[model samples]
Target: MTLNTLKATEAATLLLDWYDRHHRDLPWRVSPPMAARGALADPYHVWLSEVMLQQTTVQAVKAYFDKFLTLWPTVENLAAAETEDVMRAWAGLGYYARARNLKKCAEAVAREHGGRFPETEEGLKALPGVGDYTAAAIAAIAFNRKSAVLDGNVERVISRLHAIETPLPAAKPEMRRLVSELTPSNRPGDFAQAMMDLGAKICTPKRPACALCPFGGSCRALTIADPETFPRKAGRKEKPLRLGAAFVAIDSSDAVYLRKRAASGLLGGMTEVPGTGWTARRDGDTSIDAQPFAAAWEACGTITHVFTHFELHLSVYRAKVAQAVACAEGWWEPIASLKRQALPTVMKKAIAQAIPHAFKPV
Candidate 1:
């Protein structure tokens, strides 16, 4: 049925009923009082998870989220953590900026907001790294507010339900408006989760199982016989390629050389092998410097990684030095202790390849 055809109460009831049986057994959803309650996913937990989940897959986030909670436990604890600690915890998980923001936001809450996460959407939005989607999610799920929650999953569900023909990037605004109108006041959290669950499980991006969807009878895209084509996407731009150089210098103690990235920009606060910016240049003219080296430095191998904005080609160099250099910007970390430290994906890949060969007993 059209959104205008159904009353708010009826729509909410149908969605909630479907949610009761269909919601995934995610660890974050259980209440604090339940015997199975894990870390009592409060607004902080929910907000953190939602932020990290953006542009990240659920499977990949599970271990990282659990590790974060184990290490920090609460927002206050997170605020107390050293920048490097937080970044390391966020390592392997792409989008280094989110990790930096996560720390900045936690500190803001602890210092300015008096250690309590703001309950209102507007208040939450004012904090660092909190955006409309994240604010809405926290308000609805944590505080049981009636705000509409629209992420990619919701977008797909709404697009198919209305048979929207406008390709995505252009269709987002109209979809959000329709979703807001359809969102009900009562049980809004359940309704939002229900829609997300429905879209993920039934109205999936590929070959949506229309037969199992609750709204299949009323779905406009289903009636048209082409649900996947409703919410089309504009052509994507080709990813640009960039190249970087990283140094893997080791001392007699078997400690690997690491440097702290700049406080802002890509992979901030994470530990990494000192390197030069990824640029488009020929080998002979390239100005990339592999941090000051004592012994001869030789190119070991190259690592290719993809980021949201561009592709990176990293050239790894190995060198052995007599003494650990004091650069004010870096430290020597033993190879065994590397896992305890946070390193960006690119850094991690570079280190993974260099350790065995670069640090081998000579």
Candidate 2:
């Protein structure tokens, strides 16, 4: 089916009808019935969910979203929170930069916009970390604006619906145009969410359930074959491997030494056990000579972590001391309370390698 032959209005109507029966009941969303009864979506919740959803899945975001809501009930409360506390709360959620930007955006909304999000996409884009897609999502979902919300799922659905064979990154513009055309001025919020739901539930990436899709008749890929292969991705380059060594120091009371990373660059502003610097070309010093201070350091296996652009292999070492030793920077944290600290996944893995149950809840 060609784009011209696929009646946009009819498709939207069918999708919305399907959504009324099948939309996912999420914690952050206002239902269609609620929305029709003059109940508007909360911009703060929408924005927070959008930010958390970036490079993260819906299932993974729910707990973090709930935790944030419990800790800081409002945007003003979030804005009033200390950056360290926010960072600590946001630990284990990769992409630390987003946490920082979330704080900045909340502060901006609280201070500049008077705790009210900008209703327009343009205004939302002006806030920190509010990119085009996030701005469009917020405007449509929160303010009921007629904005084209093109996320990865929506992109897949559009590419398959029209069978746009152009490889992605290059085909995004065409997909955006198609989305804009299909987006109805009325119920644009529901329309956007409907598209998202259709993509996620029926028009999935692998072995799509086309028989159950609302757009089965209108989808060009279904008319042809292999709807799963519509949005072809560009070739990915091999991620480079980097090496480092982490030092886990423990005193008699079962307290582990931990330190905060610098306020910039990768894994910034997160808690970690002291480690040698990681570089692209060379591995960090793993010899006993590299110990922070004189102690009975023993090798404690190794942990490998994959980042966005690279992979990291760290040689872990553990040292037990009778008394606390002074270091250039950092403090001793009780091993039982290690889970409460702002440790990233990689750091957690390193610690877990030394003390097996360090991260378990008390």
Candidate 3:
């Protein structure tokens, strides 16, 4: 097995050596020096961080990771955690289903597996939300199993090193197989981390620092003088813009009307002000007529938030009413306590549009 023309063993060695010197010091990962001294990250830490890191940046996940560990210091603690509390902490993370599934996976580990994570890839995959990539990652990083761990960073590194022209999705299988072959039996976990670090630091999507790359001597993309052009991706289709309206009702004492969202769709199990259903069409309702309850609803402004599959435009409205109102399935959250609620980013944006000082620094 070889990476381009170099023997796979040699390629792994070069990458590992570079990693020992320059690997990133991330919150969920053990440093190369620690790994060299035979330390590995806890399985719970690895799993939680992996789930949080899905489609999120390291910078974004750090605070959330720290918050989670502080709240539920162990897998059993997270399993027994109130789902509402979990959702509240996961408000800004965007992908709500992952939060739900994270709770489920934790419960499964706590109850079914005796609070110990599965050590094998297949065993981990059997857990909820643990797909092939996540399972492989947990097995390698947490259990030190010889499993192939290929995330986005490693994908770029492989696509460039082999100059594979297959566009992604179609190219992923080939990339996985190549990574499996290059994974060393001993220190396999460190080897996997090294590949990821090299890709993140040296073989970046933009102007990569080829001078610092360990694989520069053998990278087919670099030899061809256009490394960035590799890992070619198919064009993205334009997301349909869905239009709706949101109502922000405030009481005499400055509390905002908010309610819990249904627990099974976009922004599931989060909090939001009343809003019209998002329908995909240019003529979908975006007027004050779509308000949850009638008041002297005054139109203020519109806020647009982009989701993975669609973009949303919400026409925001606010009205102040007497504090002696009664409502079922909702609450009047004081403006000071709104930040602690499980309001998604879109809802926060809508609230901010209605009340400019809604999320001001305390």
Candidate 4:
């Protein structure tokens, strides 16, 4: 075997052994609190939390996860909720796509599996938004089946163990393969958990706790005395800048009019102010050609937010409405209750700026 293969093999053994002893007690890892009234390690809960945890920190996701469980309680509950409710529930949590997928996946399981989560990796993967890693995780953790799981955590652990210098995105396939090789046939759940714990606690992205790591002496990166540089990253490209206009309309009752986004793309299916697609702020391009609601409208200030590949500049406008209209599909949500409604961070910032001049902080 190659030296890379040799190191990965040894690292997996030591890391799993360390994990079997030092793993933290997270609520999601334990058996149900009580048989009569408790949540179990079911595929539904596993899938839900896994989906929420993507690109989100554990601390950030904790409150949102608890709130969701309180509101929906089960996959069927979430599946049955209106799309806007799901979007709002997912407010503040970026990556709106996951929230949409959560509902779609739940509904699919409900309709096709009679409200039961799929027990096999293949079955789980067939559901909407269930990727390879997610499918393997649910299949192993919930169903106790042996399926190879490779996520960012696993990739970090495997990359360091083997000291692969390839940058990410491109390096992922090989990382997956290396981890799959180490995924032992027995106790696959424990193995998966072990790798995750090792990544989060010891083989970290920054200055790894090599002294505490079980494979400290054997880790190729550690042996080379440069753990931080092992997982080399490619250079980043500059994000494009985009600009748009947003109309925040308020009625006599202090209710703000929010329109539901189209069913796909960024912030899809979420609530937002009436707006136009992002474009350059050049004079000719930004025609404010006011609609009927312009009677109460006034140009406010602007807010800026950046996405993965684009920057958005929103020119804010305020409008007043005496009577509500069924302007497309949306809610006439109270401005005071906007916090409860899920607005994207950008739109929420715009609303906070648009708080009525009378009530605006003195």
Candidate 5:
């Protein structure tokens, strides 16, 4: 069947039926049956999970989600919580900006919005870090509004269902329009969740299970072209290479020197070891001479970490200074307590490279 030939109501009903039988029981989500039993999705949980899920995988986010809920339990609690504490809890999740904005949003909701989330998409979008997709998701799931929720999974499903030819980003508007058209007024939340679940479970990117998909007959990609081949993307540009140096100053008691990053740039407000500024040019001083303090600095290999736009290669150096020699602007954290710090993954890699046993279990 063609795109126009497939009735929106029919497609929604089929997918909802499938979803009723098989929805993933996630910690943050109130499944269809749970909704039927008078349970509603929590806006705070939905917002937190959506923020964490950006550029991150579901498996990677589960523990963090649980941790946040346990720590705050409500938007008001999160607003009252310390910013530094939130950053520490959000450590290793990458995207430090999200953590910063998460704190700001919680404060806004508690202080400005009277401790309640807004019911519509526009109101939700006004919150910090809540973008178009996030606003739609929260509105539909939490408020039962007829907003089109299109995340990566839904994008794949939409692009293939209509065989949208335009590359993503550019193709997003058309895809959204189609989704809005297909989104039913009754149980719009369930319809949106059904699409996401269908994409994740059946219409996967690689070798989609066409035999199991409810929209198998109506899908344009399945009929005219390969289903997996739809949702075409533009070619990716090569990530630029950035070079830097990391200095690990350790004392006799197995403690490493650590400092906080700047409040507003890459890895903002996170813990890091002494290091040179990352630069794309070799003229930059990524050498031992750029060490934070004078000591017997020895080269200890290098660490390569990939960021969104650049790949960083940091030359590692370690120095065993006296226990009396304390860093002027930073604190000495014991190696065993490193896990509790707000260190990003790159900083951890640098520490591990220097000590080798810094992150090992006792």
Candidate 6:
């Protein structure tokens, strides 16, 4: 089929039919049959799933989703939760900003929006962390509005189906336009999910199952035999390396001194060991003189963690002191409860390096 013959209605119909048979069974979603029978999806669940899904794989998100639902069970409950508790629950998820905004958005919805999600894209966009894509997704999937949902999966599917040549970051606009044209008014939720499922299970990044694709006959990239190469990305510049130091102070009671990060910037609102500022240019103070309090500070080794923009190498230091040692603004958390703290992956890595069994599951 040619580009002109890429009938929107027919494509949507085919994809929706495929979706009815093969959509992923997720914890947060109501099945198509249930949806058709007037079972509307919970906006809270949809919003939570979308937030967790950002920059995270579905497999990685499943357990976390289930855990959050079990813990809070409702938006009101989440809103009432302590910010520190929420951050602890979000540990290891990465992208700490999302966790912080999740709490803020929940509080806003509970307090300002009466514990209900905004049904419209614009209203949803006003919520913390709900950007254009997230708003569109929630509006369409949870509310069944006819909004065009264009996540990375949908973008790749559209780019391959239409054989869009412009590399990504630049081609996103054209891809959105094409998705808008194809988005149908009826069953918009199912249609949106169908596009995503196709990209994930069939039109994958490599070796797309073209023969099994519902749009095989219509996909322009399939005709050219290079569907994997569509949605091309520009070359990425090497991430700059940054250096820092982490100080792990264990008291006589086997409690580790930890503090909360500032409420802004990377890894904000999360817990960490006291350390020197990770400046943009210089490595943190690696000398024992920079220790939080005088103790037998020993080099525990170094840990390298990669963030989105830079690589961080932290010089790990360990010091065991008496429980009564006066220190800066931080608490002495029992080492056994380390898993319950809102330590980021990098922090966990540093702790593991200093105290080998610090984070081991009991």
Model 1 agreement with the true structure over 1-362: per-residue lDDT tens digits = 65446565766677777787777867567652451332234777788889889888888998988988899989999999998788778888887889888989999999998989888889989988888888888888888788878899999999988888899888888987888887887767767878888988998999999888877467878876698776778988787878777888888888888877777776666677877755333221122254455566777788888877678777878877788866676789988777777777677788777775432343
State which candidate, 1 or 4, has the greater TM-score.
1
What are the per-model numbers of colliding residue pairs? 2, 0, 0, 0, 0, 0
Backbone clashes in model 1, listed as residue pairs: 88-342, 243-278
Report the Cα lDDT for residue 323, model 2. 90
For candidate 4, what is the lDDT?
0.75
Model 2 stretches with alpha carbons more than 4 Å out: 1-3, 36-38, 279-282
- lDDT (Cα, tens digit) per residue for candidate 2, span 1-362: 55468688888888888988899999899876897685768999999999999979899999999999999999999999999999989998899999999999999999999999999999999999899899999999999899999999899999988888899999999999999999998789889988988888888878888899877677888888788888989999998988889999999999999988898788889998988877555578766678878899999898999988888999999999999998779999999888888899999999999898887776
lDDT of 4 by residue, 16-112 (tens): 6786578866656654233214323756667877888787877788788888889998888988999778888898889898888888898998888
After the best TM-score superposition of candidate 4, give how far the Cα of residue 76 lies from its true spot, in angstroms: 2.6
Of the candidates numbered 2 and 4, which has the greater TM-score value? 2
The model with the greater lDDT, 1 or 2, is: 2
TM-scores of all candidate predictions against the true structure: 0.89, 0.96, 0.96, 0.85, 0.96, 0.96
Model 1: residues with Cα > 4 Å off, grouped in runs:
1-8, 31-41, 279-291, 325-328, 357-362
Lowest summed lDDT across 10 adjacent residues in model 5 is found at 277-286
Candidate 1 vs candidate 4: the lDDT winner is 1
**Candidate 2 accuracy as TM-score:** 0.96
Could you tell me the lDDT of residue 186 within candidate 1?
71
- The lDDT of each candidate is 0.78, 0.89, 0.88, 0.75, 0.89, 0.89
* lDDT score, candidate 6, position 347: 90
TM-score of 5: 0.96
